[model samples]
Target: MPILGLKAPGPSTPAHFSLEPLIRPNILALQPYRCARDDYSAGVLLDANENAIGPALPSASAKKVKVNGHSDSNGTSGASASAEDIALETLSLLPPGTDLNRYPSPTHDELKRRIAHLRGVPDENWVFLGVGSDEVIDMLFRVLCVPGKDRVLTTPPTYGMYKVTANVNDVGVLEVPLIAEGGKFQLDEDAMDEAFTANPDLKIVFICSPGNPTGTVIPLPAIRRVLENPKFKGVVLVDEAYIDFAPSNSSAAQLINEYANVCVTQTLSKSFGLAAIRLGYLLAPPPLIQILTNTKAPYNISVPTASIAASAVSDAGMAVMAEAVSTLNANRDYLLETLPTIPSIGDILGGNDANFVLVQVLDGPKGKVCNNRAVQVYKTMAETRGVVVRYRGGEIGCEGCLRITVGTRTECEEVIKQLKDLLA
Candidate 1:
């Protein structure tokens, strides 16, 4: 199979880097399922078995409001409504022309175009959308790795999904631990090179930048080493799910044009506050993007999702997201400054580049990091104390650590207050 077999339009891809050879044979020859929307989305009398009489919901104007403890068709009140009325109110949020009966566009190019522009990609061809980053992860595995044969290398204490998805696909995972010394949590380049040499058959290398639990960004130079490695020919997956909170110029999306084997995954779940919409996208060279696009479900993204994502990546949406990220970053800073002041809190680990802080929970004011204490505090906060945070005391280099997401000022203060009382 040749990379040229797929007519992907973009800048000149690396001549030495061919995607087909690394892809599963069956996938290379797959005939993508063509949907009706792919052909025409215009005036349709009878196409794709769509209901001509519109969707099964009342008109948006039919929504009612309760006023003075009486049912009114207009105006607002504090009273709750029946299930039907609630459904109507939710449906009203959709555009007046949303056709739920019809299938969504297989290639929502406009949405992709906006996302491409936001991510600094060449064009929509360089992007692929999935239900979430989880789907993007699964699709990469589906297209590249052969079940029970090929393997992927992941950094420990990283996003669990990379390993989980690998396991779900019957693929083996190779662990190369990140450098935990000095709370750096960075990629150990030499160890990764050794793994590549030891496992030449590995199909993908998953690196979670602004890493989960660690919240540290793997600098671009470190990533370049892996990409330029002579021992590995597989794709280098950079999961930037938390990239929004990291410092500027910290993304691997910039490397796609330079390296054909690099793929970057991002989601609207975090910064955009659109997790319910379940939109995630991947940025890569056209060849790999095209293959993953062809392998995904024809209508994996719904019309509502596309609409929501379009608004999210729009200029106004970007402004709103930027403001939110700024606030969260400030909150994260507050945690970094305040967590260490608590009596039993030890050194806060990682770079704190993400929206969370990973801090060690000590047994007493001067005691060592204690897993039992961390677990007790975590359980107490969630179950009895009405506050919640993750206990990552079991992860590599994160013993007796609690991964706390940066929250609003009040929430951040409350957590600090709770920790002080509990540790006291």
Candidate 2:
């Protein structure tokens, strides 16, 4: 069957994919709540029912402006800054005239522009900001899948939150397990094609690159096959939360210009080391972005969050992130080499593209992979040894696997030492 909302494929251009048929009818017609900020956030603003007296918080002192661990020298030190004080400082540092009194921009275009530039997308129109990647995931489900009627496809042993969010939105999940032979957790293309033929109404396919627990990258060729699949008609949601830790040119963001159906979600939580900020975004065509903006809460991106995020995506912030990622990649290399040398450790799984390693724990040096031993090691380390790692022994083909994040050199050595002792 011809795909919904897709134009006939041309010689040079990809089949133009429209979101009209996929988005809920009501959402397409939605006249978003026009918050006060949508009009004017300027002088004499007695709007949005905000506290006209200004932010109800403690006043700021000489506080340091910290963006992803690098603190600005404001000459203040020796005391922990209170949350309110930090919030005030965040407002104080904005380009000059902005304040915390008004609602945040219904559309934070500047931040979106920075992110678009960072991700190599065309412009701000292609970007959609969310509370976090979680919100982005939820929003996709909300717009595309009809609750209690429609379904989305997920590749197993991937990010668990995809399923959780699907369930929350009352959407059914159709899971296709990744090909796990030889510890290569890649997409089973034939199986996925079969799934598409079987479930033609599937609205989204969730692909996690540098996937959680697995630390593997689903190569672009595999993704291109899915995108080029003529039988399937819905959006392909690529979750690249760990992309920065992966090799260069590993992002699906590059496909945005070519395919209208592609949507890539990323976050500050991963490589930027800004989890507390809870900032995440989606890169897609402007039509879909407009629909989401209409559906989302006005001022979803707050002043403090936007301020911090702006600093984070700046040139200086990029430098800091690059240095940090370099250290983590080196640490991951250390784990990949050292973990296998341990007697009880079995095959190192996946591509090890992310900042983690998936190593199997065994019954003995020569014994087979054992989930019981893996569980024991995971628990004992977390409880007794003060070393913690995820026991993913039950996931798909990941028998006896433990997912260990690549920490500092010292941390990597400590976990290796503890695992060696416990498995001994």
Candidate 3:
């Protein structure tokens, strides 16, 4: 079958894969609901029937909330600085003429352009904005999978949300566990191929790079092998939520320009430090992007979220993110080195390519990993102690493990301090 031949589709140009067939017919033929700000944003006086009186927030502080994303004296994004101030008084201002009384731009072209530049994609045409990667994931299932008929493939010990979303959509999820016994949390290409061959009807495969709970990146060559497979014709969704912490070459986004079957979802919630705004996007071929756009809600993103996200992905914003990633990577290294010094610590899993680390808590001060003690440590740290780290001991290949986020120097010290006292 030349459908998804095992060779590169063609080195000259992107594969001419027809996305219409991949998308649900209803979505492909969808007549998107035109939003208020779709046509004219300049002279929109009275079109969408918005409240003429403007927002209820004190206009004095509200208008002053304009989050100028331009660079600060420190050469970092001003918006990044402002966002870090969690105090309620730091109300963000809207973009010029971005009236709170009116709806936000449906396309968010400026935001898409920033994302395109950041991802090194051709242009905004290659981007699809979503409430978060969760929205993108849910929509992928909605537009690609048929309820109770079609299914998606996922690697175990990855993100849990993929399965939860699958269940919510009533779609079957085929689990192919990563090479856990190897202690690397890497993709098992052979098992994955077998699963794809067996489940020929699968429509989507979720590859969580810099995998959640694992903190390791799946190699791009492995991803290419999956994409080029003649048997699996489904779309490959690469979740790169933590790609900022990894080397640039590790991103699956580099494959989007070449592979029609590949899509990458990213977010400002992580390295960009905009989790409160809850923004994420997908980078894919224009056809797939159009399909997602058509199927998405007309006004999915709000005024404030778009403003903040646009700034976060801006040139200045990216610089800030780079510096932040560097700091976190250093902290991750510190954790990897220090966690072992604690008594009863076993091997630390994953590549340490993310802002977090997964460490195995031992039975006593040094032998084999003990899941029970790890659970106890997790609870005590959260309740008894003033710190909170995720308990991933129950996850596959992560038995007796705790997932710790690399926090500020003081916060990390507190975690290490608590672990030492508790385990001692």
Candidate 4:
């Protein structure tokens, strides 16, 4: 059965020796609801038995009166920059209850339109809103993978959700380890090719640019090579969750129109400072987007989440945040330069484009080991220094490494000072 150019295994089709079974027996047997496209049309008054009158709750800040004051130069102003104040100031011009009561356009059309404008993609090719990019990851698995039959290929020491989501869906995971020579991590294209060749049933390939934990962006040629392979014609999910931090152009968003099999997932959690709001999006072919939207539950996005995300994507705020990205990059560079000077630290993995730096601990003079010892040190740093950094030893290829998120100059200095004392 072919849907969206790719072939799904037909009822009588025999499983090829190279190709594992396409769908899990349960998923294959299950029937999905097929609602008419017109069911979601704009002019609907009564369709799916929704309350035509809408919710009874008033606007969030409607009761509170606005207090006038000068806008603070710094982003954080105590009582003066409260949620009410921020909402009143930023959205003051818009009419009351414009976005407050009505269930946010279920598919996030306006938000997607703005994102398309920003990313330079045709709105038709994008799937705009998700709870987070993590939802996109899970949705791809749910829509494409045949749980227990279809598998996903991922490079180790990459994003954890690729495996976690696979496991949740009971899908097989084929691990292709990254090259870890000299403590610098690089994608092993040959290993990836071998994995795809060995498991022709692999439905998804998750590539994280400026990867989490390591922060090394996969080289462009490596990605191109994977896409070029005939055996790897399945969806290539290039998770650009941290791409804004990197200097390299995003492969998924940039090349979406050119490749039908590619999907790029991004989150406002990192750069947009809206992690708490949980707005993530996927840019993919419209056919794939249709499948995802069909599978997803109604009212996936809350009223508050939509409002905050829309506000964050405002032009003025995005420009200000671009400078914040530069600041974080500067802090990352500072840590990269200053960290190796500490006697206890060994090689640093990634400080390339992302905000975090991964540092390996060196052995002591007595030949003491320090890889898996990161958790203890992580706890010490948190307890004594009042600082927190991710310890990544338990992750696939991250033995003996701590992932530290770069903050303001003062914050970075405080962390460095604490590390220096610990090393001493």
* C-alpha lDDT values of all predictions: 0.86, 0.83, 0.81, 0.70
Top candidate by TM-score = 1
> What is the per-residue lDDT of model 1 for residues 1-424, given as tens digits with 9 covering 90 to 100?
6543356654443444567789899888776567776666677547788787766665433532321233445422235666565555445445655667787888899999999898998888899999999999999999999998999999998888888899899999999999998788988888988898788888899999989989999999989888878788888999999999999999999998788888999999998988878999999988888788778889999987888789889999999999999999998889989988999999999988888999999989989999999999999999988999999999999999999999999999999999999999
Which sequence of candidate numbers ranks them by TM-score, best first? 1, 2, 3, 4
On a 0 to 100 scale, what is the lDDT of residue 224 in model 4? 66
Residue-level lDDT tens digits of model 2 in 42-69: 6877766777765555543222233323
The TM-score that candidate 1 achieves is 0.92
Which lDDT tens digits does candidate 3 get at residues 222-283? 99888888678788999999998987799999998888888999988899988877798999
lDDT head-to-head 3 vs 4, winner: 3
Q: Rank the candidates by lDDT, best first.
A: 1, 2, 3, 4
Pairwise lDDT winner, candidates 1 and 3: 1
Clashes of each: 0, 0, 5, 2
Candidate 4 lDDT, 234-346, residue by residue in tens: 77788888888887464457666666666788899998877866889888756566556656776788766766676677798688679889888889889989988877777
Q: Once model 4 is optimally superposed onto the true structure by TM-score, how far is the C-alpha of residue 61 displaced, in angstroms?
A: 5.9
Give model 2's TM-score versus the native structure: 0.90
Compared with the true structure, the alpha-carbon lDDT of candidate 2 equals 0.83
Off by over 4 Å in 3: 1-18, 37-44, 59-62, 65-90
TM-score of 3: 0.90
Structural similarity to truth (TM-score) of each candidate: 0.92, 0.90, 0.90, 0.82
TM-score computed on alpha carbons, candidate 4: 0.82
